[model samples]
Target: MAIYSSTSPKFFLSSASTSTTSTTAMSTTKKLKRYLELDSSLEDEIPSKKKQQLPRRTCLVCDVEKGTNQFPNHKKVSSHEHDHNVCDPCYRSHLENEIDSKGWNEVACPECSITLTYKEVKNMTTAENFAKYEQACIRATLAADPDFRYCLSTTCKSGQLHPGGTDEPIFRCEHCGHKHCIVCEANWHQDQTCEEFQAVRRRLHAENERSQQEVKKLSKPCPGCRVPIQKNRGCDHMRCSRCRHEFCWVCSADHGLIFREGNHRHEKNCIHYRANPRAQEPELPRHRIERMLEPDTRLRAYNRGDLDDSDFDGSDSDDSDLDDTEPWDDEADLPLVYEPDLILSEVRRRAPGQTLSRVYVG
Candidate 1:
C-alpha cells in the first residue's frame, strides 16, 4: 500500500493549480510582450512611472481630498494662518446660503473666521446669485447717503431726495399721495404756518402737563385694590371697582363693616369725621387747575368772552387776583360783557347806525 500522510492531499492540490495556470499564462504573457516591444521598437521605452493626475488637496469644509480642478474659481479663502481651501461644491453651497440669510456682508471661510470681501464672493457665485448680491450692494450704498430719504407713510415704501428740502416743507409722497412736512416730519398742517403749528403744539404740551398734575392732585388710590379712583361727582364714601370693597375716598380707611352693619362710624382722624368733605372743600372740576395754570390767559379769556360767570368765581380775571376768590361787587360782575354782538352794537350805537365800516380783528 502507498503511504498516505497529511502532506499527500496538499501536494495533489498544488500540482492541479500549477497545471491550470500554465495554459492561460502564455496568452497574458504574449499581450504584455507585444505592448513592451511596440512601445520600445522605435526608441527605448522610457523607464517611467504612471502619468500623475492633478494634485489632490484636503477640503477645509468637508475634510475630503479633492483634485485642484474641483476648487472654487477664486483664490484661497484665508491669507493668514488659516490658509486652507474648500471644495467647489461646499464653497458654492456656503455662498448661496449666506447670501440668502445674511446678505453679502462678511462672508467668512467655512472652517474659520477669515472673512472674504463681497467682490471676491461675487466672482465665485452663479450669475443669478450675483444679481441679488449686486442689488443688496446698491441698496446699502443708497441707504448710506444722507440726502436720500424714505417716505414716512406706513403704507408706502417709496422715497426720493427733495429738491428743496426743508426750504419747501410740504412734501407730497408720490406713492401714497399724502402731503407731510419734512421739517416737522408730520402730516401737512393746512391753513397754518409751521411756526404756528409748533406754537400750538407747545401750548397743548403745557396744558397736558398741567392736566396730569391736576389728576395726580385730585385722584386718590384705593387702599384695598390700590387702583386710582377719582370721586369727580360722588360722596366721600367710595367703593372699589373689581373688589367692591367700600373705603373712604379721602382717608382710604376700610368702610366695609360700616356699610354692612348700617352704622356710618368712621375713623376719628379722617376728614369726614370732623366736617362734611363736600362743604369743607369747594366742588370745583379738577380741570379748572389746568385751565387756570396760565394765569396770563385768564384775563385774555375773559376779554375774549370765553370765560362765563358760572364757570369761575366772580373775582377779577387777573394774575394778582388768582388767590382772591371773593365775589366782585354787582357793578364789577356786570362790567361790560365782551360779546361780539355788543362790540358791533357799541360801534353802531356810537351814533345810531348812520354809516358802518367793516372792522376785522387780526
Candidate 2:
C-alpha cells in the first residue's frame, strides 16, 4: 500500500490531521463565542448544576429514606429481585450478626427466607469470615457421611471419613498420627475390647463423684445427639459444640425457628416459646416447593425419617396441587433402612461406561 504514494510522506499532511486541525479551530471559536455571551444556543445545551435525583426508597430496616445505591446488591439477580427495602449498612450489619452467631452456614435474607448463594455470601463477608464459612461447610458435608470422624487428640482439630467404618474399628488420624477407636469414637484402646474400655470407664466414673456432680451442675445433654454440653456464661440459646444442635439451655429443647408471635426458638414447654394462634407456614414460591420433591432430596428426607406417606400426597399441597404421588422415577419412596440401590448407584458412578440403569436423582 505504501509503494503507490504519489507525494513524499514528509511533504503531505494526512486527511485525519487536517480534519483534527479544523475540528480544534471550530471548538476554539465555540469557546470564544460562549465567553463573549454572543450565542444563547449553547445555554440550553449546557447541563444544569442541580440534578433531579429521584427513585429514592425507604429502608425497611432503619425506616430511613435513602438513594438506590444505598441498598446492597439492589439489582434483579438470579437469587433475588431488586430489593430496595434494606439499606447497605443494615444489610451488612445483618450479615455481621449472622457471622458472629456462628450461623453463617445458611444465612437467609432479612426480607425473605431465600438462602444467600455462595458468591453473594463471599461478596458480603471478609476473606477471613468467608474462609471460616468454607471450613464450616466442609465440616457439615463430612458430618453427613457415616464414616467421617474427628481426630481424638486434644491438640489436633482435624477430621475425616474413614472407609469401611463398621468393618474396621481402628481409625488412625493422618493429621496428627493419633489413633482412635471408631466403634466408641474415643481415644485408642491399646490391647482391649470396646466393652472392656466401657467397663473401665464406668468404674472410673463411679469413683469420680466430684467430677460427675460438677458436670451435672454445669452441663446438660443435647436432645439431638445426647452429647453432654457445658454452658460457661451466655444466653439460654445454647448450641451444642459437638453436634451443632441449637437448643434452650434451661429446657434442653430443640432450638428450631418458630414463627409464633414472640418469635420463639424453642419448644412450647420452654419459657422462651410463645405460641401465635394465627401463625401458619411461611409461603415459598411454587418452583421452590417443586424442587423439594426432587429424587435425591426426597430420598435423603426418607433416610432421615422426615418423610411419610402423607408427604407424597402432592395433590393436597397448597398452590401447587401437583398430581405427583410418585414424585420421581427413583427409589425415593422406599422405606428400607439399608438400601441396595445405593451400592448399585456407587458401582455405576465408578464405571461410567456401564449400560446398567443407575439410581440417579431428578
Reference-based TM-score of each model? 0.35, 0.43
Off by over 4 Å in 2: 1-51, 73-77, 102-105, 210-362
Worst 10 residues of 1 by lDDT: 286-295
lDDT per residue for candidate 1 within 68-103, as digits (tens), equals 777754353424364347877787788788778875
Q: Count the clashes in each prediction.
A: 0, 0
For model 1, name the residue pairs that clash.
none
Root-mean-square deviation of candidate 2 = 35.0
Total residue pair clashes for candidate 2: 0
Task: Score residue 117 of candidate 2 by CA lDDT.
Answer: 76
For each candidate in turn, give its C-alpha RMSD to the true structure in angstroms: 28.9, 35.0
- The Cα local distance difference test for each model comes to 0.64, 0.66
Tens digits of per-residue lDDT, candidate 2, 1-362, equal 11335675445557878888899999999999778674564565453322235367899889998877667763322578756488877877776667667555667777886778777877766677678777777788888888788998989999887999758989888898998888887888899999999999988988798788988887888888888888888788887777788877877765565422233445668777654422433333343323333445445655665666566554332323333334432243343232343334344445557554324332
